[model samples]
Target: MKGVEIRLQVQYRARVDESIEACHARFTAGMQQFGPPFGWQDLEPPPAPYIKPASGDMIGVEWFRYPIKGLKLQITAQHRHELSIGTDKDTSDDRLSIEFKTSNKALDYRAILREHFPKLIEAYRGYRAWAVFDYYGGRYTDWNWGPWLGREATNPSYQRLCKEPGVDIDGRNNIFTLEPAVFWDNELCRRALGYGPEEVMRRLQGHALSVQPLLDGVYVVFDDDPALTYERFLEINKQFKELLGIA
Candidate 1:
């Protein structure tokens, strides 16, 4: 996993009937709780871009400056929403992507994972979301085009390629995930999903790196060791499947 860097992703549905401005405001307020100087730069260039707190449209950013050791965050937003609004209308899923790179050779990514990962998870209040820290979890790269020609390198094909080894093809066999997290979020205790967050914590008691409760979910760190490999991740995911009986 030389080229593979640790990625953090959180996926959830947008609030019912929430405008982009309202959504943006709520998001920024929550993130700001992580404290000042952790602010976003609107990537959508202004004739006046959406810069106002919580009341702007189509806000985007490439880097968010965080206070930890001058670690500039690479932020990507994939929240797709339509103009129509109603209680009956289904909200679209939104995602925030962050990355920790090897460029800062002086700092250990694992140390960052240990310290700020949960705080970052707490900073976002999504309707229903799951945050995860994994190597290449659902990101696109040249690997998709490496093996196939023009048509096959499309998004769906790339997703299938990323998922095939760690997940069942139909995407239902184990929690709708591909590369599972070394650190992950479980929102709302997931009672409807048949496993309580505490139960997962109990089951993974000794084996897990760390498991902490969030306001509405649980944060799990699978392994913190420097030697963790992709193959080892698959093994831990197998253990996860068995412990939760989701496989």
Candidate 2:
């Protein structure tokens, strides 16, 4: 069977006053810790205002490693958008988003990430983040809000599909909260999980492969690699969500 690809990502609302130049400066400032990035390129067509040499226009970041084929670090900026979490009363608008992501593929990917993931999180300070191994398919945002919601027993999507009068298992939605991933970290852990980093570590003692407390958030790794067969992935994910009382 083909191996699944793992993705580690951090996502947060951009500062309202943040400028493209600022984003460029932040990337340059943080790159030193991870490694210098080269081969910068603009993501959009000509006259792309976000493009800046040695600073901006870079949607993907690559480091100089002797033999790693696809090892890369990516930082992407998104325009402001809104998602329908529920009813009109539940709507919330977010500022443009700033995301940082990396993948586990190359031989040295995990080693490098283990050493630098915390630094990346500190540099970006994302409110929601995850490290998951799933089939390469639809938008990450479409299926990833569950953990961000922490222990919410039900979300708008879940309620929409599972709670309507005559619906059965066939009508159940895939949205889940507090679902497990290979790795997790974010600034909202305390508020969302009802405990601080240390307590979270205590709670996850047996199930968690490793628990790390970072400067701004708690980092939890559930396994050596997020990638796994679909059945195995679901097994791990289910066990964890249930353990946390969020299944």
Candidate 3:
């Protein structure tokens, strides 16, 4: 089992009204405040020599890895950062994800998450509107796409195994969108909100909703209207904690 790397990725999605430029600026300002002691120093866009797109809804951004410190263990956590811009149907989608990759066997994943969850939550103060409290990724992005092709009268997920993107499903009066946890394995380290599209939209009305339940127990909630705000999202997260053992 040599060279088998284990990494933990945590993310959350946010709906923003700002353009890519504005969103990047906000991220840049925060970049100087990540990590311990001081945070990422000498942070800047990719040096001119080897610059290329990092893929998906990225208008512009710089990449850096903040070394996790203060852990009195053999494991090393190199936290990779992504400030991306994307789109959700018409709403601007922004993503921020911190991935911790380690080869150390002494580290406990839950302990690492619990230690950083509060800091991560506090870091996302300014851009909370339509901000989903659960870990999904993004504070921005233009990757506007859905996860389904068509909604039949019945959802096939009730039967059979599904493991791909853009599959047709039952959409009758139901909202079909991409299931959260961009990488299913990535969700293993996340604190799930467990709220389906119907439930999320239903809680904060003024929008049509649909849900495509997955056999994996994860779900995709399609919000016909992205009007949920950060305050409302916070409220929802609080309720999620109360109703479900999300945290």
Candidate 4:
């Protein structure tokens, strides 16, 4: 697994899982691998057939950064494989994204982390963390389109993507991701549906290229809001399946 990691400073409410390697602890027994940066102390466990966290190593130059409190992260980084679209150098490996919190303002952890010489940890001052959730808890790569970031970025277009005829009650700070098998980058485009990005843009208020995901798509997950992006994606996907002659 190779990718860039982004750390931000925010105020979330949750407990901490001291170690990044969650292998020692698990939400359930017999769960293999501990990949996610956080312990997911807040996210409600996935329904029925639970999804255990997927684990793997991310090849990188070695670096570090920031945090927040109470923010829940429930991702099993199995989909650590992300492709570089525009440039052959998809330095996703260079990035390490995580959200943690500490009352120890006395400890200049950032300075200490850098002083040790492992690497420089960027200071994401005033960074706002988002609530990432999923139903089944899986990861995929088709979500990343390079320059276009997901809802995790500042000023995401949630109203157009998440809110619509009716808004999601808990859709705040929520964004959706789709499995590649479910749909792909160009499927909804004019070439596939006789409509261009503009039309899709008008419908979603966001470009497909802008739907960036963090770590294989685990951080983003599927659109939980059934009334908005979820249904829209499925509807468009139905047409795509018909066009592809898929049953």
Q: Tens-digit lDDT track for model 3 on 7-100?
A: 2322224334333444344544654566542233454432211223464332333444444442221111111233233322212223344443
Off by over 4 Å in 3: 1-17, 37-61, 67-92, 105-108, 124-247
TM-score of each: 0.61, 0.56, 0.33, 0.22
Segments of candidate 2 deviating more than 4 angstroms: 36-67, 80-106, 109-113, 136-187
Count clashing residue pairs per candidate: 2, 0, 32, 19
Highest TM-score: which candidate? Answer: 1
Model 1 over residues 18-111: C-alpha lDDT tens digits?
5445555566666655542233333321121133445554444445545445454543333334333432211234555565554446456566
RMSD of each: 7.2, 9.9, 15.1, 18.8
TM-score computed on alpha carbons, candidate 1: 0.61
Rank list by TM-score: 1, 2, 3, 4
What TM-score, to 2 decimals, does candidate 4 have?
A: 0.22
Report the CA-based lDDT of candidate 1 relative to the real structure. 0.47
What lDDT does the true structure give each of the candidates? Answer: 0.47, 0.42, 0.30, 0.26
Tens-place lDDT digits, model 4, residues 1-247: 2211222212111113222233213322212122123322333233221123452343212222213333322222212233233222112212223333322343332332222101111111111122122221122112322455552322133235434543321221222323211111222232233543344334433322232321111111123231233346555434533433322
- Assess candidate 2 and give its TM-score to the true structure: 0.56
lDDT (Cα, 0-100) at 185 in candidate 3? 15
lDDT of 2 by residue, 21-107 (tens): 465556445544444222122221111124334553323222222223444444555332222234121012111221222342434
> Is candidate 2 or 4 superior in TM-score?
2
In candidate 1, what residue range of length 10 has the lowest lDDT sum? 42-51
